[model samples]
Target: MTALHDKAKGKVNPVVAVGVEVDDAGNLDDVVLYRQQAPHTYKQVKYTVDSRSPLDTSYLTGPSKNGGPSILRKVADAWVALTRDGAPVELALVTNRASSPADQLLAGRDARTMLLMPAAAEQTRRSERGRLRATWAQATNLTEPQLLMLLNVLQFDTARDLRHLEETTSLLMLVNGLRGDHQAVRSGADWVAEQARYGHRKIDLEMIETAVRDQELRTGPARSVLSVATLKPDPLKTQAVHVLDWVDRFDGDDAFSKRRPRAPFTWQQLQADVEDIPHHLGAVPQVALTGSLRQATAFLIGATLRMVTNVDLAVTQRGQLWESAADYDQATHPILAEHSLGIGEDLALAVEVATPMTDDVLVFLRTQQVPVDRLVVLQPPRGAKDNAISTPAAAVALTVGLRDQARRSAKGHPRIHLFLAGPMGLSLLLGHRWNRVAPTTVYEEIRHSVQYEAAFTINA
Candidate 1:
C-alpha cells in the first residue's frame, strides 16, 4: 500500500543527512537535515511518471541544483523530528560550493563547546535562532543545532576577543546545571569545606580564596609577609590532633620530646643541589646563604631537589651556574639581561611547594586568561643554600610576578598573595628573628607562625 501510494503520488526515494544533538545529561537528539518538502512534490511526481522501479536514469527529481524544495523538505522533516523529541532545533542555510548543499552543511561541530550554556546562548543570539536558555546561564543540555550555531559564533571576528570563552562557558554551564533557584549559584561551600578538612584542595576554593586574599598580598613593601591560608574545620583539626596525640601517646613523650634535632647539612647544601640541576632548568647556583632564613631555606631547596630529582647534593654544586653572585659579576650582568629567572617545566612541576616568579610566566598566564588566586611566593635563593639565609628577595620576586599576571588576566578579578616559602624562607620573608632550624621543623614553625602573628591577619 505504501509503495502504491508512492507510485500514484509520483514520489521517489530521498537522500538523508543526519545531525546528532545532546543535552547536559548526554542524551542524543539527531535531526535529519535533508527531507522532501511539499513544493518538491511535483519533481517527485515527474520522477515517478518517467521512471520504473528497477530502471532509473533519474528516479527521484531531487531538489534543484541550488537546493530547491526537496532539500528544504528534508531539513523540515528533521526539524520536526527534533521538535517532537523536545530538542532545540533551528532552520538556516549553510554555504557549500564544493559538495552537495546538504553535505556542505555541518552535521555537528566540536561537541565540547556545545555542552556549555554560554556558548549555546551566544550561538542563538548570533544566528537569530530560537532561545534554548531562558537566561544567560540557563541551558542544562544542548541540541545539535544549538551547538553548531555556537561554533559558528565563535568563528566570528566579534566573539574571538572573548578570552577563555571555552573555560568560562563551561564553568557557567556547570553552575547553571547545579543552580537550584533562578537567583544564585548554588553553594558547594559545605562540600568544599569538608574537602579542606580532609586535606584535599580544590581549584575553585583556591580561586575564591585567592580572590579574597589578593588585597592582602599586594600591599607591597609595607606588608612584607602576606599569608593566604585556607582554614580547615574543627573536626579535621580534631582528627589531626587525635593522630598527633596517638603518636605521642604511643611514644609516651611530652611536647618537647617531639622536637627535632638540628639538620646535619648546612646552607652549603643549597649550592650543591642548584648546581646539579641545569641552569636552563632554572636551578639555583651558589647562594650567598645568610640571614635567619638560611637553615630552613637550604633544607627545603635541597630536600625538594633530592625529592623531585635524584641528583646527589655533590652533583648539584658542579653546575657552572652554581657560582656565587659576587664572583660571577660579569656572567651575572650578561645573564641578568634576560630580565627574568624563568624556570623549566621540570622545576615548576618539581617545586610545586613554592612557585617561581618570572615576568614571562606572569605574562604567559595572563595571555592564557588564567584567574588570579592568592599570591604564590616563588623566590630563588640568592645566597649559598648551606650558609647564607634570610631575606625577602624570593617573596618580592614572587609577588611581582603574581601581580603582573593578575593585572594581565583581567583588570579586576581580584588578586591573591601566596607567600610560598621554606620554613626559614618564610621567616626571612616575615622579617622575624628566629634560630636556624631543620626544614621540617621550619615548616611546622612557619605554619604556626602565620597563625599566631597578629600582623598576618588582615582587616577583612
Candidate 2:
C-alpha cells in the first residue's frame, strides 16, 4: 500500500496519512481521508474473489486448502471486530464471484440466514464445531452466545457474473500484482511452502470502487449517493462546451444557423462573448485561496477564467522568478492597447501577499492588452515578517486589509479584477472573505502559455 502511494503521480488524490489506518489484516482494503468529498472520514473495505466456477453454497462454507475459515466469514468477523472497536467506518465487502440462486449475496439482517443454512450451521455441528475451534477460535473467539452478533454484523457485498461484469480480476494476477505489500496484512500464512513469504501490496479498495462508480455515472445506473460524492459540476467544463459550440457556429456547423455574414457573432467573438457572462459562472457563490498548494490555486484559476474574464495581471518584483517572467514577457509580449469598455473603473487589484510579485503579473497582463484603471496592492504588516502570513489571525487580517483596499479602490464599481500572488492557503481564505463582495473576478498565472487568459470567475 505504501509502495502504491509512492508510485502515484500527478494530480491523483493521494491518501491522507491521518484517518486512513487499516485493520489488523489488510488485503485489498480501503481507508482514505483527503478526497474533495468526505475529507478526514474513515472507511474500511474487505475483498473476496472467486474465479473458478459459479458458487453453490459451499464456496461460502468450504475452507481454503489448509482448512482455515473462508475469506467471507473472516471478513465478516473483521467487521464485527471493527464495530466493537468503536472505529467509525463505512465498511464494504468487494468480491468477484457469481453465486447461484441457491447462494445469494444478502445484506444486513437479511444475511443472517446464510449462517443457519446447511453450509454453515449444520456443517458447524457436522464437524462438531472442531473446525471453528481450529480456525476461527483465535480470530473471532466464536462462542455460542456471540453467534447472533456475528451474523448481524457480517454483511458481505458480492460481485456476481464475473465473465460479464467487465471489471472482474483474475485471482492470480491480482495476487501477483500485489507482490511486495506485506505491511497491511500480518495474520495470514503463505499456503505455498507453509512458510514462503508472500503478500501483495494493496491500495484502498474505495479507489477502485470510486472509479467504477464514476464509470457507472457516465454510462448508466449511477447510485445517487456515490455520484454525489464523486462528481462536482465544473464551470470550465461547461464553458468549454460553450466554447466548442462557438467554434462550431463559426464554422457553420450548427444545424440551426446557416452560414451568413449577418450573424450577431463570429469566431473571433468567442473569447469576447464568453468573457461577458459573469454572474452565470462558478458553481460556488464564493471562491477561496487559503491553501499553500499550487494545484488548488491553479484549479480555481482555470475554472474561473472559463466563466468570466479578460485579466490585467501584475507580477510584483520578487527576485529571480519574477525577473524571469518579466524578462520573458518583454521578449515575447510587447504591450498592446487595453480594450476600451467605456464603463465603470476598470479596476486592477494587486496581490503582494507571501512575496512581492504584482509587477510581474502586471507586465504579463500588459502583453495580453488588458487594461487596469486602479491598482489595489495587498501587503502584510510593516515589520512583521517574511512572505508567510504567520498565523490564521494574520491571514484573516490580510484578507480584511485586501477587502478594504478593494472597496476603496473600486469606489462604487460593480466589478473589480483581483490578481493573487500569495500562499495558496491565504488565497483560498481571501476568496472566502470576498464571497460577500460579489463580482470580484480572480486571475491566475498560466505559467507557460504564451498569452495570458482569464482563469475563472471568482464571485464565489
Candidate 3:
C-alpha cells in the first residue's frame, strides 16, 4: 500500500521499488521499501487476532516460542549486520497488537514515527524512558549509544488491525484511480502474492501499473476526513483527510501523564487554529475530534463550533460515539442534584460528574477570597464517580439541566465563576448549549497540585 501510494503521488528518486521476502537471513526482510537516494526501510509484519494481550517490554525481551531469540535481540542483530557496511537503513516492526498499559518504555514511542521521542530520551536516569534505554541495551547486548542509534532508525507500526489496514488500502486504491471494492482489494493482494511466489522479489511502478491494468480495476469518487486533536490519537485513524496536530506544543514524554502546554502562547494559537477549520474544509458537514484535552479547551472548541454553524461534531468517548447533532431522549436521563449556598450578587458554579470537586472548589473560593455571594454545587443524585453518566442522553440532559440551573441561580448575579470536573463530552455539550447565561470565568486545576488557576472566560 505504501508503494502504491508513493507511486500514485509521483514520488521521485527516494522510493523507486518495494521488495517482499527478499532476504531469508535478514530479520526485517518480510517487506522492504526500496529508496534510491534515501535510507531503505525494511519492515517485519506481525499480525495477531488476540486483543487481550498487548506487546510489552517483557514480551519483547523474553524468548520466543521454542526458546528462539527474543524480539529485540533479533532486531539488534539485524541492525548490527546491516550497519556494518556504513549504509544508513531503517527498520520497522509492523504489528496489529497494542502496547501494554503498564509498559512505560513503549509508551514513550511517537505515534507517527514510532521512535522514542527526543523528549523521552532526555529524561532523568530514574525516568521510564531512561529505564527503557538501559533495559533494552542490556537485553540486546549493545552499548547505550548503539541502542540509541538503533532506536533512532527503528519504528513500531502498531495497532494496525487487519480491518483498518484493509480500509486504508481500499481508500488509497480509490484515490489512486483504482477499483476500491473488496474484490479489487483481494485482487491486488493476490497479484502481490503471485509476484512473490514467482520469485519476483522487487516490484516497481511500471509493474504495479501493468498489474492494475491487467486486473481491469475501476476508479471512484474521492473522500476526505477532518481530524482535530490536541494530543495525537494512537493508531491515528488513517481515514483523516487533514490533521491539525498540536502535539508538538506539548511534552512528548508520556501520553498518560498530565502536563501543560510548552508555552502560554499555545492556547492562543490553538484558538486561532480551531477558528480556521471551517475555512480550510469548506462545505464539509462533519468533523471528527480525537485528543486528550482539558475541560476548558473542550468547552472552548464547542463554543467556537456551535450548531448554528451547520458543521456537525463527533467524538469517541468510552468506546461510544457522541455527536453534537445526534438525537437523544432529553426527558429520560440522569437528574442533577443541585446544592445552593447563600444568595449573593455573583455566582460560583461547580459541576462534578466524574468525581466530587465541590469541596475543593469551596476551599479555593474561600482561600482566594473570590467575591461571590452564591455557590452552586451540582452532582449526580447518588454522588460523583467515573462513568456516572454513561449514555449520550444522560450527558445531554445533565448539561442542559446545569445550564438552566446556572441561569436560574444567577438571576441577580452578573458573573459566574465556573469550575468543572467531568468528562470532555459533558464539557463540550455544556458549551454547545451555553446561552443566555451570565458571563462566566472558567478555572483549571493545576497539574500535580490541589490549587486552581483561571484558564479563560467565556460570554455566550
RMSD of every prediction: 28.0, 19.8, 8.9
Tens-digit lDDT track for model 2 on 111-163? 21223223333334336343443344334455644553444433343443434
TM-score of 3: 0.57
Over 402-440, each residue of candidate 3 has an lDDT whose tens digit, in order, gives 778777777888898988888887787777777788888
TM-score of decoy 2:
0.32
Model 1, position 362, has a per-residue lDDT of: 45
Residue by residue across 259-327, what tens digits does model 1's lDDT show?
Answer: 222245322333343334343233322111211122233333333333224222210111111111112
How accurate locally is residue 145 in candidate 1, as Cα lDDT from 0 to 100? Answer: 57
Once fitted onto the true fold, the runs of candidate 3 whose alpha carbons sit more than 4 angstroms away are 1-43, 46-91, 95-112, 115-154, 158-234, 251-253, 264-266, 332-344, 447-450
Model 3 lowest lDDT segment of ten = 218-227
Can you give the TM-score per candidate against the true fold? 0.16, 0.32, 0.57
